[model samples]
Each structure stands twice: as C-alpha cells, then as structure tokens.
Target: MGGGGMGGGMGGGGMGGGGPPPDGLRLQYKAANTTADDIQIKPHFKIVNDTQDNVPLSDLTIRYWFTRDGGANFIYNCDFAPFNCIYTAGTFGAATGVKADMYVEISFMPDAGVLVTGDTTGEIQARLHTQNFTLVNQTSDYSFDPTKVDFEEWTKVTLYSKGVLVWGNEP
Candidate 1:
C-alpha cells in the first residue's frame, strides 16, 4: 500500500467538495521604457506575481524561443522566477527594422514545494508603457503557446490567476 497521506495537488484550502483549493497563481508583465542605443534598441518588460501563494519567484530556469512574423527566431533561457523585474532583449539592429509578429514560448521544469498560499511573485514596481503594449488577462492549463502582443513592436505578456477571474477577488 502507499505510505503516508493522499499525495498530489497544490493542497491548501481544498475546494468545497474536497477537490483542490483554487489555484492562486497570477502572473503579469509590463514594460518600463524603451531605449535606442547607438547600435540597437533595448526594451524590457516587468513580470509580477499577483497572488497569495508561495509563488515561484526565481531559481527555476525557463527556456524561451521567440519567432517573429518575418520568420526571425531568437532563443534564450531565463529563470522561472527572475530576480530582476524586467526581461530585456539583446538588441534590434538599427537598420534591420523589426516587426511585431512575436510568438513566444517558455518551458521549465516546475519545482515542488515552492508554490504555497502566500509568496512574493517579485519585488518590483509596475510600469505601464501604455503607448507600446496592450494588456490581456487569461487562464491556462499549465500549457502555453506563443502569443502576439501587438502588430509593430514587442509585447508585454503575462499570466493571470484564474481564481481571481472566477471569485472576483484576489487574496
């Protein structure tokens, strides 16, 4: 027979029918500002975890691949929870000219015991580059596909708590 307790799931304040506590995970992103260097353009997006869970902050690394509309591809690896609020791209050549057809996919091996009822998503302030990006809040089944943010420049992508959407409240 199996050893100790019924092992599986986020296990916190389980649902009414003893199912599972509502998932308290909300991830968000926004850009601080944009800079055009003598060589390239540097734009960054800030990510936040707006929830009451011991959310995964950093240490867990995630690999990302970006495919632009013009079939340009970029690959990089970052932490599941980055210590830095903003994720900055290397550089966009001055003359190359860029298009927004940006599809981004991130994958990582989730670490156990990191997600709880209350945790700091990240210690960062929010910045809204209103002119550059639009915001979208949606739910996911832990699976993701590259999504487009805008048409011309890059996008500020993020993850939102499904629980908040359903309960109309955030703990």
Candidate 2:
C-alpha cells in the first residue's frame, strides 16, 4: 500500500480549530496502491452537518486519477463518472465505520496489435465533492487498519468492453 499526502491546511480559528466557524469541510485523496495484482482505488469523503442549518448537496462531482509508471510523473484520469458509479455511505459522528461500494470501473487494452512485454503496474487516485454528497453528522471510524480487519471502503464495478488476454493472446 503506497501512501500519499494531503495538499491543503485548515483555516485558522475555524471549526477544525475550535469556536464558531462555518460547517464546511473538505478531505482529499492522499494514497496510492501499486502492487503486482490489479489495482483497486477507493475514495472517502466526510460531510458533517452539525448545525441546525440544513445542508444541500446538489450537483456534486467526484474525479479520480490513475497512473501506470511512478515518477515525476504523467497522470491519467479514470474513465468513470460519479453518477454512474457506486460509492460508500455511512452515518457516524466522529469515529464510525464506513461501508464500501463500487464507485468506478477501470479497463485497459493494448493498442491494436501491440503487445504488453512485461508485468505492468499502475496507481489510482480518487477525489470527493461536497456538491453531490452531504453529511448530517460527524463520521466516525472513517479510517481503518488494513492489517487488522477487512473494511469495505469501496466497490469495483466490472464493465465488459473487449476481449481479455489469455495465454498471451486475446480470448
């Protein structure tokens, strides 16, 4: 499991800090996986509507990025949309378990007649939006220890677009 980093910081004297601040929060994708087997990507988003005010999540869009070679690095977008994909949803206040669902589908094929030489590896990235998903309470147990237990953070949907490779040939 490869680990990534978050880019932004919390606002000073904000809700993340303490006191009367707006109820807007954002968490970005901060991890990648590059193992021998096929890559699986999952995105987790948290929305906390603690105030009496009702929050509306309309027109939300989530984007995910994937990469084959690890380097200073070229990036490719996963060919899946949030509306068509399935994702995880949970209700917990500051420490709850999150269920996983299929949020996207990925497929790859060698360009006509071209052949893949050796074992190939890739990376995946996921992003969440506030517009489509809204949180009514603080999310608990959002993070889990991969070694200790099996948690369904996301599900992968299969799309049969083309023939698969079998015994070094298209089946």
Candidate 3:
C-alpha cells in the first residue's frame, strides 16, 4: 500500500486515542487487514518529517501496541519497508494496561537512511504472528483501527525520536 504524510503544524483533537501531535516527525498508519480475527496482525507505517531538519532513521522507533492472546510468543515480519524490509526489526515487550499488555517495537537499521524536511519514509509494511498460530483479536488492540483503510495521522501507535516522544500516546 502507498503512504501519505502530515504537514507541519496541524492542530486537532487527539489522533486515534489521545494527545494532539507535536510538531516534528509524524507517524501515519493504516490497516491492510482489518478483520477482527486473523492468524497475523498487519500494521503498516510511514514516517513524515514535519520539522525543517533532517531526521535519521537510526534515531527513530515506532511502537505498535496490542494485547497478547494468552502466553503466545510472537514472530515479527517486515513484508515491505522502502529502505529494505529486512533491515527493520520488531521485538515485543511486556506491558501492563487495560487495552494493551504487549507492544511490538520497530527499529530501523542504518540502511533505512534519513528523512529530509517534508519528506516521508514511504511504506513500512509489517505484521506479526503467534508462534502457536493462534488468531489475533485485533479489534480490542490499543493501536488497531478497523475502520482506517488509508494512511492517516494516528496517535494510538507511538513514535519516538532518540527515545523522546514526538508523536502519539502510550496505552
């Protein structure tokens, strides 16, 4: 799927959950597969450089939060990422919350390159599967959107620049 970006200084209500986007790098998302039940969860991402300065991919991290079905272990895959899907890595972290108990943290290798001002990091198509092949209940995910068919500015999935929150909110 193709990606779209958010320009600098657009103000509005909280994106998908809470917190208006801060002016800097912006994260956009869309669900390739919105089914409530699936063998795997697909979450596509694209990054927009809202600031005037260039932002390196090495300094950024994206987190897609969701709940784990039981004690299921997950395996991550980057089906497509402009810089090279193989260079992107996803790891899970145990978290405590009502909507999300786990999150897939996505990080990029240096090969991903930099995003100049007003530029966007095309599409980062990613998905995860349960090791035991269990279906994922995505409708209740903190970052999953069943109605979003196109890339839009989303806050449910968070973005961090050098470990500082520049966009979205945590569950």
Top lDDT: which candidate number? 3
Candidate lDDT values, in order: 0.26, 0.22, 0.79
Local distance difference test, candidate 1: 0.26
lDDT of 2 by residue, 1-171 (tens): 111111112332122242233222222232232122322323332222233332122111222222221122222233332322222211111111222221222222211111112211212233322232332111111221223222222211111111111111100
Clashing pairs in 2: 60-132, 86-102, 95-140, 95-141, 96-140, 96-141, 100-152, 100-153, 101-155, 102-155
How well does each candidate superpose onto the true structure, as a TM-score?
A: 0.33, 0.22, 0.85
Give the residue spans of candidate 1 off by over 4 A.
1-24, 36-71, 77-100, 111-113, 123-156, 160-171
How does model 1 score by TM-score?
Answer: 0.33
Model 3 poorest ten-residue lDDT run: 1-10
- Candidates in descending TM-score order: 3, 1, 2
Pick the winner on TM-score between candidates 2 and 3.
3
The Cα error of candidate 1 at residue 70, in Å, is 2.8
Evaluated with TM-score, which candidate comes out highest?
Answer: 3
